[model samples]
Target chain A: MRRERRRVERADDVGPYRLLRLERDGLDAGEPGQFFMLEAPGRLLPRPLSVCLATPAELAFLIDPVGPGTRPLAALAPGDAIHLLGPLGRGFRLDVERPLLVGGGIGIAPLPYLSARLGGPPALLGFRTAGHAEAAALLPGAEVVIDPVLVTDALPSGHDVLACGPEPMLRALTAIYPDAQLAWEAPMACGYGACYGCAVELDGRLQRLCIEGPVVAARRVTGASTMRAGR
Target chain B: MIPVLNASGCLDALTAPDVARTLDAYVTKTVTPLPREGNPPPRIAETDVGMLNSIGLANPGIDAFLGEHLPRLAGLGIPIWVSAGGFSAADYAHVCSLLDTRAEVDTIELNLSCPNVDAPEEDALAIVAAARAATVKPLYAKLSPALPNLPGTAAAVAAAGADGLTLVNTLRGLALDPATLRPRLAAGIGGLSGPALRPVALAAVYACARAVDLPIVGVGGVACGRDALELVAAGASAVAVGTALFADPGVPGRIRAELAVLRGRVPDPGV
Candidate 1:
């Protein structure tokens, strides 16, 4: 159903990013790290922001203030109105074994919810610097390894990895464990599969960000772009 | 306030099995008078920020359209804005006269600036003249963002008696395939949408708004309320979601809600 999702509830400073929690009544069972397209109040295009957490009654997004888009997003408070088309992209995949979860900066926001979905304990996460402590803190049981120099060598090997963050971090992990499952972030043209805008090479084939995988096997990413992404 | 989407050709609104329930507005593919299957294959190509289309106004003739398809779209609540094309001005008028009689249809949109089509500018003017001569209902002219002196051109259309203007259809373009020594899309060209077309569409709306007093329906790359609002602020009476709606059916509704929020009014998303 094409129903507009208005922000009925909101909270500020959830760890590092300002979180906008939208409540819409429907059959939306949004998965963790899955995202929604929020129509920025008066912009020409909708920004495809990532979801930090999800539930049946409500869905949540953790966004940092930035650009013309995030500026308005930062100013929004409870009772403020916004529209969202959600649960649109494919999210994380938990293989139930050796899940070496990793995140960076605001990208780390998805970790906690992802951990909860994994149904168990701590996983190793590497950040760019110690100042980025908030994201590491949000995820329960995080093995915080600060300092960039040791990153390539310090990551504990021998675990199935699930990671989301800037390109550099993912590139590091991709080289380490090419077989580990990786969730990628790509710009979305349409959350539906029509435009072929948000495509990535997956196993020598094309995959659409809106339909194929915001989440995919670590081996599938070719790091190509056909469209721009949302927040 | 009316719920109408853009008639950007081959948008494939008929993607899902059930078309009626999916979109409130169903714009017919741009139709010419005779059976024109359109430009050769490899019709759509790509560009840096946007894409291009060279469909050549493919259609199965106006008679077949009315006889075979009109009944299927009848009783649908939304207005069927026929984006009409013609070999000459008389062709446009002749087709509009035929379409206006059907109670289910009312507005006739004249295609003035399709880069992929063959009609000349004077021919478009004549068609508008013809449609004006033929029908009493409103007639809208769809224009290009690329044409030199767009505002002046729009003013001319308004003076020529067009009821409204749809600013900027797909900008002409091409996309090459490195491996195939050919274009990627089947048509060799296609209309570019998404973020790439936003600025051109905006400029067109702004120019047209300043040029004429007629209501303008903004189109191109609107995927949010802010985009729509920009067109409104630029003098567009309405905006159309061409690329976005086909990509995400729920975008229009979401954009509507966000628009309510931007105005500080709590949106009642009566979903």
Candidate 2:
């Protein structure tokens, strides 16, 4: 709800991604799966990052250096300052009795926080390689998978699924877990619904993903698909 | 004092009411006669200097606006400017007539130059005249800066009964993915806004202000107070924050504060 320039406490490499830790500075870490718009230095547009971990004093983001927007975020050194605005968008409804966290690649960014909110629920995380799988360290007790083997392949039954990852994985998960909670991503300009830049066709309607979701129920999405990755 | 408004489509007041309260008047996104799904995704792209978007005028249409959005916005206690878009002159006039009775609508801005849609070839004069005849509310024509005869169009629209002008909608541009070498936006091209648009917008405002006597709301890449001051110096009666609102919703208040500080340093030119 506020925009502040929080100083970077650390930017450590975890496989091919960066674990960016910033001083919390009065910003609320809202519900798990909610995202912040991180204004990457030197980039015209800010990139949306879900909170990877939130200690009382610091908020951490797991970033993959995918392209122009995220490379600078991954390159930030300690003592650098970055502007961020968020705790925006709908997050997971943590009312489930038997919660199961599912994530793929960088989508694991939101799972750690979500797990904490769900009182350390079981997790299944899938990455592309052994190096990429190193990020699994953040989710202490979660099972890990690499590409050629999807996390959906190992999905356990009868648990309320909370998921985030690439579009393909989400689509497959939604097909199986009709009541699952999924975090989706689209290229966004304004993380609040103003710009309509994040509009995705859901159930034959163009819904602004920023408002209806960074997290949404699986049944609400019919054919919506996104090429961009991350939560 | 000059008003600091948000350019149409830049700020959704319902979602960000606090940001809307910072503006002198809140301009709604372009609402058409019918609901539009907008362009396909990959709709936004970040350039080296600014941004490109092909949103295609997505909205809930006027019926939904009056029934749902306007009533909520009325509670915000700020003047509301409705941005009307259409495929034809009648479409513009029809929307204007529909809004004529709504007391909450303080102004109607005819979006005659949305680069994302296939706009009609009818001149601004025709669209402005149609809207002017349809509604008693003050009408402001939101024109594009990419026009070949911007000054002439401004003068004609003014003579046709436009009360004011919002100078410069985004100019058309394209960004491609370096990996694929294909269009970055699914729509193939998009309207460019942000810091790269400041000069083009200033030129439009400067030229139109000289050609017509109507008050102008200058908008484009206004990110800071200096940017707003420059627009005023170029003859704008008011300034609007556009793409910058995407990154910083607190922009209108910041620019206003900066403008207040800056106005003291510059000698009064009696603009």
Model number with the top lDDT: 2
Candidate 2, residues A1-231, lDDT tens digits: the string is 458899999888988889999999788998999999999888777888999999999999999898887888888998999999999899999999899999998889999999988889999999889999999989998999888999988988999999999888989998899999999998888799888888776776878889989899988887556555322
* Location of the lowest summed lDDT over 10 successive residues in candidate 2 chain B: B262-271
Candidate 1 lDDT, tens digit per residue, A50-74?
Answer: 6666666666667766555666776
Off by over 4 Å in 1: A24-27, A55-58, A149-151, A194-196, A203-207, A223-228, B1-21, B24-143, B149-167, B170-240, B243-271
Best by DockQ: 2
Rate residue B44 of model 1 by lDDT: 34
- TM-scores, all candidates, are 0.58, 0.98
TM-score of 1: 0.58
Number of backbone clashes in candidate 1: 26
Which residue pairs come into collision in candidate 2? Answer: none
Model 2 docking grade: medium
* Per-residue lDDT over B166-213 for candidate 2, one digit per residue giving the tens place of the 0 to 100 score: 988999999977889999888999999999999999999899988999
Model 1, position A115, has a per-residue lDDT of 77
Listed for every candidate in order, the interface RMSD values in angstroms are 7.1, 1.6
